[model samples]
Target: MDTILWIIAAIFVIAGVVTIVRGGLIYGIVLIVVGLLIGPGGVSVFS
Candidate 1:
């Protein structure tokens, strides 16, 4: 489960970067923020 979450987080980060380069600034920022919040070292407030 942990590994899966990390992988998802990585995908989100990459997607965010691509979105930003493609001019989807708001979506990109949202994805990146979500990624950070759920990433490996992120704050586990919900967890």
Candidate 2:
């Protein structure tokens, strides 16, 4: 389950980056937030 969540989080993070690069900052932020919430390590992913 944790692995699955991690994969999903990775997808969201990638999408967020793509969105940000396209100038969709709000959408990117939203995706990143959701990704973190659903991620295995949560905020620790950044650490």
Residue 1, candidate 1: C-alpha displacement in angstroms: 1.6
Q: Residues 1-47, candidate 2: write the lDDT tens digits.
A: 77888999999999998999999999999998989888978864544
For residue 11, what is the lDDT in candidate 1?
A: 90
Tens-place lDDT per residue, model 1, 5-27, is 78888898899999999999999
Model 1: pairs clashing at backbone N, Cα or C within 3 Å: none
CA lDDT of every candidate = 0.85, 0.87
Backbone clashes under 3 angstroms, per model = 0, 0
Task: Give the poorly placed runs of model 1, Cα more than 4 Å off.
Answer: none
Candidate 2: stretches off by over 4 Å: 43-47
TM-score to native of every candidate shown: 0.84, 0.85
- CA shift of 41, model 1, Å: 1.1
